[model samples]
Target: MNTQEQTQLNMLKKALMQSQYATVIAQCDDVLASLTSPEAMREARYCKAVAYRLSGQPDLALHDLQQLVTDFPDYGRAYQEQGYCYQRQGEDQNATYAFYQATRFNPALLAAWQQLEQAYQRDNQIRALQLAQQQISFLTSLPKPLLGATDLLHDGQLFKAEQVCRQYLQANKHDAEAMMLLAEIGMQLKVYSDAEFLLESCVTLYPDNDRAAAAYQALLSKLGKFPQAVKQARRRLQNQPHNMTIQAGLAHALVGVGALNEAIELYRTLLADQPARPALWVALGHALKAAGDTVGAIEAYQQAARQAPDFGDAYWSLANTKTYRFDDAMIESMVVAQHGSTVKLEDNIHLCFALGKALEDNKQADQAFSYYQRGNALKRKTLRFDISRTEAALEAQQQACQAPMFAQPGGCHAPDPIFIVGLPRAGSTLLEQILASHSMVDGTMELHDILGIANSLSHQGNAYPFNLARLSDAQCQALGQQYIEQTRAYRNGAPFFIDKMPNNFIHIGLIKRILPKARIIDARRDPVACCFSGYKQLFGEGQEFSYSLRDIGRYYIAYEKLMNHWHRVLPGQILTVQHEAVIDDLTGQVKRLLAFCELPFEQACVDFHVTRRVIKTPSSEQVRQPIYRSGMTQWQQFEAHLGPLFDVLGQRTNR
Candidate 1:
């Protein structure tokens, strides 16, 4: 290679390391065009392909990798790259074939073996463990016992796996997998510092390992260092440009940092390359919806559903797009029937609840009630909670709020927020839509900011128990400020914001402590009705609470107890919004709700359907329609079927 060529190559390499994908591609393209030596030409093409992959252009990367392997048949790395590209494109068979070829060409390519294992895992093939075992057997000299620990870890035995990893690290302290396993264990245990140190070591030892990079970025995100995580993800993408996982991580980081437009662009590019990836399509739909392009978002979700018909996420996304309650029953039925045969109990519950709401909205009260009963039966088996454990915490929080330990000295300068708290199916979403329609309020559906702050504080030893009374006055004030700051990212200078996480009922004590001045609305419904409603819907993530009926009933009881406690301790701090009452007197209830929120009544509040704000809840369809009486007294028809739940709910039955 000439001096000029070497310099140009060096510059291209630097660009690739920096994740300047476009610059690297341009440099490589020029280098390949001018290359005289066959070796140099092949190398340049490979570099170009890497750059293209990093830039979220997987098809171009695949084309280049395929041409490289064809021309340089003995190049094992070329085959490995081709396999990875194929995997990203969901051509699992082709990916496996390419990995096999790479292994045949070079038995020492452990990365190819790992990729093969992942492809099998993705396909949920039982033979994946056997394949991994086979690959482990091929290693002439095991680097460390950590390899075995990884095998156990991958099989889901975290405690045993971590023990094995710790044993391995005692002898060989520098084992990257051992370090990473420790990190995983730490994360699971909520030991942030231990996880961070272990991840940092793993990344340092194996900079080219995309898994290590991803883990590091995840830890960073968990620690609330989103910008740094984004930077690290971008850097990793430079070398593994065609890496879909990294692309997704980058998009998520961008969203975390409020770089929505850039995240949208990156997601679009990823979707264009891997059009059939339902998760990617769902993400794109969310990004588009957040960007105020509801039509575009709906189309994206529909395309996702068409590509992966059984994917629960796509159905959930579709259910959240329609502009009227009239379509709610149809969407719910479709989702339920689509996933009915599976053992996914939560999805069944979610769908049933959705169906009940839809039927009630359509004035098919008898059918809705039947579904509501089925839903409640399922919930009683699925959802569970410890009321005694939570109530103690609520009492403590009430005392702290009354004592004014954390009250802002000059009085709260922050905007008053209308917080909607309940179980998922208790009409919190609808309340937010009505409130958001008023000129003084902006409904930010189910903001994670409050929960994120609470979680962080809990992890940081702030001495605040899960219940309210345990919080010191100072701690409560700090929590409030932290919540406001975190939510500032989602706030668009609106006078008031609605934090409508149904599960936020669990944190009502802490919420009252922090935002004593804020208005809280407990969206109450018949216990059987609410539990049943939660049974038929399919939540895509983090809903371990809805997998069984007993759990659901227990959860409801805990929520109710906490809400009742709030009423006793923080009188006038909260208002009760009955879902049935809303149905019976839409305008009157809405007027009262507006008065509670301290917002002037506007005609828009009654005609909330005309507002173009993005709705992120399962009730999105219902909220976009005008008020109706169909949802009132919806549990009557299923009275025979829901006897057990009715018995449990007892005198608390709102009906």
Candidate 2:
């Protein structure tokens, strides 16, 4: 949207808030016509719909609300407005459903909660009534400004939410809920350290508050503080022994810490009592798959699908196994579920990806790509990744950390970590598996401490790569030591450990500043093959670019540009390992890798497929067997559908 249109939208929103309904409704169309962005259009339409309903045009309001909700399925305010329209029209059932949807998409919609409370009480929906009552009570009890801030937070207006919360907290520093809400906004903004500090203060002040405890546990987990998360979860469970949520949280923490047996047992125990919960089944399936029991994982995933036919995660979980082939009946069921009444955006995305995989396995290339594209389009709606931010960060790294910056690097000199940095789906995991096969090397899951530290450091006054050059030797050593201390729980006593975090390629400068002696490997692949592979797969978190073909291709180009900068700056510091080279000459590549890391040659690294460890990546199943030639040229089959990707990647495929 242009500045003038955005300014008009801001004015229209204020006018609506002030009950200037005629003005808001009149100005919305002109403001919307000039606004080209989907988000801007959504905001304008919502304002118009709300204004129409308040101005006594119930049918007209419902018409626009219906269109708005259709276009932006996850817009909670649109559903809320739809509820108000339905209520005014005396369509009680429709109002009830709309209010329920509003609350589901955004729990901070106080009016929706109030409406649902009344509807549930009237209709005798006992479970829903209790939930609605709880939600309404929570929302109603908040301070008025915090309440507004809460709604803003739910509506994706984080800047406004932060402003309100900061103003309120300036006078009411000890308000726990306000503190929690602000901390949550910080998390949304990726200001992890600030969020951690706020959550810690909130929890310390209100030790008995379950909400504070829950939020603290969540933030801890998100930052990869798994042991701390486990501790918090255990404490919460101790306080409420029968709380299934706390039990599940602990199970997830256990999985994060690689205590798979305990996590699996905990999930099974939760399932024995609550077998009807499809989410629990899927969680158990994840644990089982991470532990390499594919059969048990399949059974768990299938049971979840059977329990809730519209639960798309279960079907996607099955497809994500990388080796699972869906039967005709299963595919038919997924098709029906995709079109089912309870289908939502996430379900549609999951079903599309699963169906794409099913069709691809059956050699239906065109149909497979169609589903993949649909899934990517839907998935992109749910992410907020910015290619511009990525490019800016890369440019800043180049500007801040040149050869002179590396010259002053007197870091911790810790030779313990071997960092594997690259783009996802570029065979980083395969390299980790091979190196981990060496007796001196321990294969930890893609550790998050590096990214977490980078995030925390970025919150400093100057941001990350720029601030990195200012750290003194002592400060750099302390930060590097902090990393070692934080990641100690994930490692065994091996002299060397592999930290195969692919996106760490972007943080190479920071890595050099902290751990100057660390072994860095840059995993590379054929651009088209890597981009297409990433586009088709669904990641659990943080590889948002993979959701779209053009985005993934552009990310690759950007990644290559940054890596080239690193190579020029650091000379022989980073070893660029092509995925194809390793596949073709395992022995030769293994020896070369060991030579770089200063490890003696080991035959086990060459025969890495047989070395058993818990692999958690999507490549787990494929990397467990010997290398093959089949997947290298698989992108050629879908070449006809990859026009945008080819344009973005400059047609880098050998084929």
Candidate 3:
């Protein structure tokens, strides 16, 4: 209340308003040091704590809040601030308790109610819905909407959600929730400019709303304003020191801006508390790996596995990490455990495929083959297109590829590049790893560049058949140019790059015409084994192809027929790397593979895993180890369970 104290307080407030959090923190600290009156000191401590929290120093903020509550239990704001700090630290239980205390002291504190609801939602407690409903009811009885138009935005109905929010905002033009909701709706619609405007409005109107702050930070991140995002995240964390979500968001922004060390520190702090969160563990593991702390990364992954035993990602990472090692018993055990535990046939197939890789890594060729076979068997049952239909498509594609190119002249672009195409989980990734290890070859896993080009060329009015042969010579040339340009992004100036889009099997004809200089490598496994493997693996997104068994099998059969046709027409243009053949003659096959790619043999190529390169594939772990023979015959163990698959394979015995 004195002039000097008032001056210091005003400076702190001004610093916060300008988002100069560090200055605010310093000002608060100076004022606190000079305060003598108990009431004034309490106020100064609160301000300092707020500043600390905002500066990404939540532990210090929590300490101040805790001391304030201990000294004055009736302080509602202190309880609310303490709850926020606890939430940021991911101490949900403590955060809930603190929010309850805040509500008990001041029932009308809507921020406390909102924080409590978020805590419940984060924990996935059913009571969260009831609490949200209660908050909504309280607002409904008010003459004016205290929040904004966007407060009415619900899940599942985007258009209706927007309309409700807009109507609410029309009635109360100054509603922060409505502005925030409009921003959210804009973000959803990919209208970044609109969203940014609304978020800015919300921040200006409701400076105290941490949700607005969080949203503003997210918008800044979207706009590539990482420094601003980091600043905002730090400030928001001060308001709620314990919140893991805020910490994670801040860490992500830091990582985006290449501040790996800082991000690592933040992740490490988060992990120290909730060491069991698989996502946090995975993120920390990735950061440590990027920092070249392989041992530390492994330890983090192991801890993640221990915490969430059924988490497939942890096991997958572990399996991949050990794929090149001579002893992959741990990988085998995890894969087998995964296979045994999951009732979904697809899950088992993926486990079997991984098991095959682990077995191969361990030099168990016969067992590896069996596992590979089992994976393929499962795959055959789920494909969408039949063998006959695929064969017909392949015939058409071959004819198209063979047709003379008169438009651009120069002998139809000269197919000089090698492509490894197949359905996913059919040893395509493994094959790419092996070939990429060669001195003259570079492997680019599953690039979308080629497919995107093919898609554009195939567009003829409304009737797009998803068939490659439907495209013309001119279209193919244009597509080929697009593919080359797109792939230029991934090219490390290597002589040869592998375009291993598994679905590129569908566009072999288009690829041949566009890059007539490209060679084609079809990575084939037994249909049953491939199909089964496809069934078992869980893709993160955009694999609508794996939703059913029969669809997968048909897709495989179609791929096989096309590959076969390409072989007959293009002849030596396409090389077949049978999964079994590769396993049977590792050295001989690799030498042959090197000859095909016109690369001089190197002993180092045989031990490819030791060569460090950025591997962006699911098999990153497997490629790190030396070659082994474990994956040769892994299907026999699950023979009883694969009757349908076996029947289909039985009919294809002639092939």
Cα lDDT listed for each candidate? 0.68, 0.88, 0.65
> How high a TM-score does candidate 1 get?
0.62
Which scores greater on lDDT, model 1 or model 2?
2
Cα lDDT tens digits, model 3, 1-655, are 4767767667777777777878767677667888765556667777778877777888999988877765655566677888878877988888887887776555546678787777777778787658655974665554443233222232222455577667777887967767776778776654565677788788888879888888999877665456668888988888888899999989877754446789889998988887779878877776665444567777877787678655545555554554324245567455656655222343454556567666655657667657666655555433322455545655555556543321233213633356888777667766777777776677644665555554444444532233444456676667666666656645556777787777777676566656777777778887776776665454543344443455556566656666776666566777788887777777788888777777788776667667665444555555566655544444444445455555544443321
Clashes of each: 38, 0, 85
The lDDT, on a scale of 0 to 1, for candidate 3 is 0.65
Worst 10 residues of 1 by lDDT: 403-412
Best TM-score goes to which candidate?
Answer: 2
Pick by lDDT: which candidate is best?
Answer: 2
What's model 2's TM-score? 0.96
Candidate 3 has a TM-score of: 0.52
Please tell me which model should have the higher TM-score, number 1 or number 2: 2
- lDDT, candidate 3, at 5: 71
Candidate 1 residue-wise lDDT, 181-299, digit = tens: 78887776556667877888888888877678889998877665666789999899888888889889889777666577898999999888878897898888887766557678788
Q: List all candidate RMSDs to the true structure.
A: 18.3, 2.0, 19.7
Per-model TM against the reference: 0.62, 0.96, 0.52
Query: Which stretch of 10 consecutive residues in model 3 shows the poorest summed lDDT?
Result: 148-157
